[model samples]
Target: MFSFSRSPYMTALFSFGVFLLFIFLQNTVIYTSLQTVFSTGGLCACKKCVMDLNDDDWFFMRFNPTVPALLNRRNSAMRSDVFTWWKGLQSDPKKANFSDVVDVLFSLFPDEEHHVVTDPNRCRTCAVVGNSGNILGSHYGQLIDSHNFVIRINKGPTKGYETDVGSKTTHRIMYPESAVDLDNSTHLVLLPFKIKDMLWLISVFTTKHVTSTYTRVRPSINAVREKVMIIHPAFIKYVYESWLRKHGSYPSTGFITLIFALHICDQVSVFGFGAKRDGNWHHYFDNSLAHFSRGLHRGDYESRTIHELLLMDKIALHKGV
Candidate 1:
């Protein structure tokens, strides 16, 4: 019943209104994208400059001068730092033969330039899998195997539970007490608690001479000497001082493994970390056990740090089943 005249001025006004609407829509989309990036850890969607800054070189540069220098087979400074860290943390030599133990420990680590990668195109994607009960029905095996590097902590097994937890393990982290029999291909990363733990690792390969530590360890292990790696004591101290902010006397091995992945890998994804909102801590393989003790390591504080990292987009945490 009503029609506007097709005048030049009227047409121009309509075109101007349409133009403003388009601009408003564009701005709205941009705002929404920015909100997502900021909400989930302020990551730049286009290029992860923050991730680039978290490379091994960055770690070496930032913490090399400070306590807990990044440990590698080659770095003399890191070797010295790790040695001192072990000396300071261990009990009196009278209690244990730590004086001669250092000599044996140093023998296992050869003097060679160790590099994590050789290929320029090697974009290492690492999955740091924990032993939390949440991963029981996750069916993350295929997802986990897809990663370039799959790191498992302590006694987390994938034999029977291969449907949920992947069978692939590039690296297995353990102390002497928690040591598991690893395949030849999988790297055995020794996370020593004391001088005796280090001695236990050395004995595992060569001789069953140094057996008893705080507890009895396996007489020998079945892992390749070429694939054996020792975690630096200084690096452990660094995780305590720098990352967890001295939340507890020391950081948990799982937490340390997560940080270690960040240094070595280009892309890091974490699985089976923390509990549900109900706050129950149990291993995936066993449901009988519950509640992670806060006395040794501040489990709650470490969980908070992980959440903050998730929000900041430092690491991707898959928390639930």
Candidate 2:
């Protein structure tokens, strides 16, 4: 039999070795899991890295949502191109806005020159987190927070639910009604549902003159002034026509935010979207089961589209636990 002595130094060294081994094993498992999801057919795994946006990735034109993508013929045909007053104000444009509420929109944001992407190939990764109740037990917080940009939607709460929804918010997508308070670091992305929504946003800082529209809204909001982003009406229409394929009159805030991720992020991971626990459409923050309108939006169709995007290697969708 081999004789062994238990010295304090030896004990300490052994413990340290064991700790190192544990860390190595943990990292290996994480790598393997990410590889399995991201590298399904020899796709480059580097896309999984959470790096900053660099110059080469400048293929993503920082969209100016203030103006329409197509200004001339397209705008005339579909007023939603710019969400101008010409569009049926009450019918599906959500709300109405007059033509006079213009020229001032540009003044509300940072200079257009500051909008271009300076860093490239930083391997930008973004996580678009939704409010699906399926995320309740999914410990996706750490994974979601690992990304360079974490985009949360509307009122998806991180408090008391950090395990499911990561306690970070680089961006939050909302309209006037669905708006929620944000940390000074978070970007308050306004998805204008109508003309009044745009006016209301500007009014928040300048006049505080426009408050209640279709519903009550904060005359002023708490957010980093420089970080505010408006979803271009043209982009919304593009999502409606190209991706959603006219499945609904308009895309849901969740779906629009997902498409937005595809534009700005090199690698996108989606979490807490779709239905949960017996095909019920419910929010993680609330227990109330809801349903999407077949006329307004085809939730079933959107789900299918998301699956297709996953297969095409466009995005990684975490269907949740």
Best by lDDT: 1
User: Any residue pairs clashing in model 2, and if so which?
Assistant: 53-119, 54-119, 54-120, 55-119, 55-120, 56-120, 65-232
lDDT of each: 0.71, 0.69
* Model 2 alpha-carbon drift over 4 Å, by segment: 1-45, 48-86, 89-102, 113-120, 293-295
Q: lDDT of candidate 2?
A: 0.69
On residues 1-321, what C-alpha lDDT tens digit does candidate 2 reach at each position?
532355777778889999999998985675555445433223323544222122222211222223342122223234543444324323343333343444555556643432224244346679999999999899999999999899999889899998888898899989877877799889878887677887887887688887787668778777776777776667777777677767767788898898788666667999999888577878988889788546577887888888876765667889886
TM-score of each: 0.74, 0.72
On TM-score, the leading prediction is 1
